[model samples]
Each structure stands twice: as structure tokens, then as C-alpha cells.
Target: MKIDFEKIAEEHIEGFKGGEGRLDTRNYVDDRARIMYSTLRPGPKSGKHPHAGSFEVMYVVSGELTVHYDGSEEIIKMGQVHYCPNGHQHWFENKTDHDVIYFAVVPTLG
Candidate 1:
């Protein structure tokens, strides 16, 4: 199937943080995979959380973000990607001075 993405900016925007309040999401379920598009604002964070039943893979589409996982943290900037395995704790934040866009993939019902 083909998916048009022109209206994603207005349809799916949740889990916003400080600086600016916006969360854009485009969720698609394919077989058992759930694909999503998320946008974050500067000085905002996804906060610390854990993936209960899914492994989340994220691709940074624009700007920069700091990712914390397991017991360490790293900056996943623009053009970079990161993966958080299932049952692991992770979090992401836009500590930079610019906006950031990212795409995430997870399992259905996860």
C-alpha cells in the first residue's frame, strides 16, 4: 500500500516537551511492525522510560538529540540512528538549540 505523508505534521504529535509543545506522529502497522514518525522540540525530552515488549529503532531525520540507555548515554544527532532493545530502559531529549525530527520502529502491541 502507498501512504501519503503530507498531513502527518498535524495528525500525530504527542509526548511533547519543554521549549515548544509539539509531537507529530505517523503510525503504520505492517504485519507485526509498527512504524512511527516523531518530532521533538529543542530543550524537550522523551524522559526516561522502558520498552516493555518492543525494540525501538530510531532514525534522526533532523537536528540533534541525546539518548540514554542501559547505563550510558550518547548523542544521536542528525543523520544518525540508534536502537533500543526490548525490555530495556531508554530516553531521548533535544538538548540542542534547534528542533529535531526522528522516525521510530517498534513491534505491534509493544
Candidate 2:
């Protein structure tokens, strides 16, 4: 199956997961998975949260992102991918002046 992101409506989320600033995204979500094309504005971040029953995979498309995973920090630049396995906690931060664009997928587990 193919997904055309250009047709999807973008949503702006403020303080996503209890973090600062905003996140702009176009999403495709269902019971099986959550897929999104997103942009993180400078100074905004995704709050640290546990994966719980699912795992997330994020691919950086442009710019860079700082990830705090399980008490450590990681820098994910363009062409890099970051994965957060189930039961782990992680968050993303955009600290540069440019926007950070990425694609992400979160799959639900049985």
C-alpha cells in the first residue's frame, strides 16, 4: 500500500506530550500503527514518555534532533534513524535554528 502525505491535513500540537513549543504533523493512524510526517520547530520538544505497549521508529529527513533516551542523549542527524523499543522512555528536542523534519512510525503490540 502507498500513502500520499501531501493530501493529508497538517495538525499543530502545542506542548506535545507535555513538552514545550509546537509540533506540526500530518498523520495516518489506526489500531495497528501510527505513521506521521512531522516537523519540530526550534526550541520545541517531545516530552519524555514510556513506550508502554508499542515501539517507535523515527527517521530524520532533514536537520537534526536531540533525543533523550533512558537517561542518555543522542544526536540524530539527517539520514539517521532512532528507535525506542517497548518499555523504554524517550523524547525528541529540536535545538537548531532550522526546522527538523522527520518521519515516524509507532506500531501497536499484541
Candidate 3:
């Protein structure tokens, strides 16, 4: 099946998990997964939080992002992907001057 994000997704500004600044997100949710096309301005971050019942994968669509997980951090540039497994904590920070664009896929566990 195909999902058309532009036609069906809802956009919102949210400060998820205590992150700094607001995040612009176009999201699609279902019983199996939550898919998001997200953007963040430079210096803002998605706050750290544990994935208690889901695993999340983020694919960088533009600019750069730093993924922080389990006490370590990695820079994910355009075209890169980062994964946060269930039961672990993670966050994303945009350190560049440009807006960071990414797609996040979070699948339900069990």
C-alpha cells in the first residue's frame, strides 16, 4: 500500500519530550506505525525519551542532525539513517545553521 503524506498528513508545531524550540511535523499514524515528516530549526532539539513500546528509525532528508542515544552521539547527514531500538532512549539535535528535514518511522512493539 502507498501513503500520500501531502494529502493525508496533519501538520503541527510541537515541543516533543521537553526539547528546545518547536518542531514542525507532518504526521501519519496507524495501528502499526507512526510516520512523520519533521523539521527543526538550528539549535532546537528533540528531547531525550525512552521508547518503551516502540522502535524508531530516522532518515535524514536534508541538512544534518546529531542523534544521541544510550550515552553516545552520532552525526547523521543527509541520506543517513539512525535507529533507536525499543527500551532505549534517544533524541535529535540540529547543530547546523540550516533547517533540518527528516523522516521518522516508529513502529509499535508487541
Candidate 4:
């Protein structure tokens, strides 16, 4: 199946997932998973949290982000991907001058 993100309305969220600043995203959610195209602005971050019953995969489309995974810091650049397995903790931060655009999918565990 094909998903057209352009057809989805974008939402600007403040303190997304309890993080600072805002996140602009277009999301498609169902009982099984959530797929999204998001842009993380500079100086903002995704709140640190654990994936209790789901796993997340994020592919960077442009720019970069600093991912705090578990207890370490990883820099995910354009064309790179970051995966957070179930039961792991992670968060994303955009500390650069440009926006960090990415595609993410979170699949729920049965």
C-alpha cells in the first residue's frame, strides 16, 4: 500500500511527548501502528521515555538529530536510521540550525 503524506494535514504540537518546543507532523495511526512524517525544530526535543510494548524505527530524511538511547548519545544524520526496540528508552533532539525531517513508524506489540 502507498501512503501519501501530503494529503494528511500537518499538526504543530507543543511540548510533544513532554519535550520542549514543538513538533510539526502528519500522522497515520491505527490499532497496529503509527506512521508519521515529522519535522523537529532546532532547540526542541522528544521527551525521554521507554517503549514498553512497541518498537520504533525512524529514518532521517534530512538534517540530523541527537538521539539519546538507553544511556548513550547517538548522532543520526541524513540517510541514517535509528531503531528503538521494545523495552528500550530513547529520545530525539534537534540541536542544529536547520530542521530535522524524518519518517517514523511505531508498531504495537500483540
> Number of the top candidate by lDDT?
2
Q: List the residue pairs that clash in candidate 2.
A: none
Q: How does model 3 fare in lDDT?
A: 0.88
Output the lDDT of residue 24, model 4. Answer: 98
lDDT of 3 by residue, 1-110 (tens): 78777886556566678888888888888999999988888888888899999999999999999989999989999999999988999988888899999999998878
True lDDT of residue 65, candidate 2? 96
Candidate 4 runs further than 4 Å off? none
For every model shown, what is its TM-score relative to the native structure?
0.77, 0.98, 0.92, 0.97
Candidate 4 lDDT over 1-110, as tens digits, reads 78899999999999888899999999999899999999998899989999999999999999989999999999999999999999999988998999999999999898
lDDT of each: 0.75, 0.95, 0.88, 0.95
Superposition error at 83 for model 3 (Å): 0.4
The TM-score leader among the candidates is: 2
Q: Which regions of candidate 3 fall more than 4 Å away from where they truly are?
A: none
Cα lDDT over the full model 4: 0.95
Candidate 3 vs. true structure, TM-score: 0.92
C-alpha root-mean-square deviation, candidate 2: 0.6
Model 2: per-residue lDDT, tens digit, 39-62?
Answer: 998899988899999999999999
User: 70, model 1: CA deviation in Å?
Assistant: 1.2
Ten-residue stretch with the least lDDT total in model 4:
40-49
Identify the runs in model 1 with alpha carbons over 4 angstroms from their true place. 9-21, 29-31
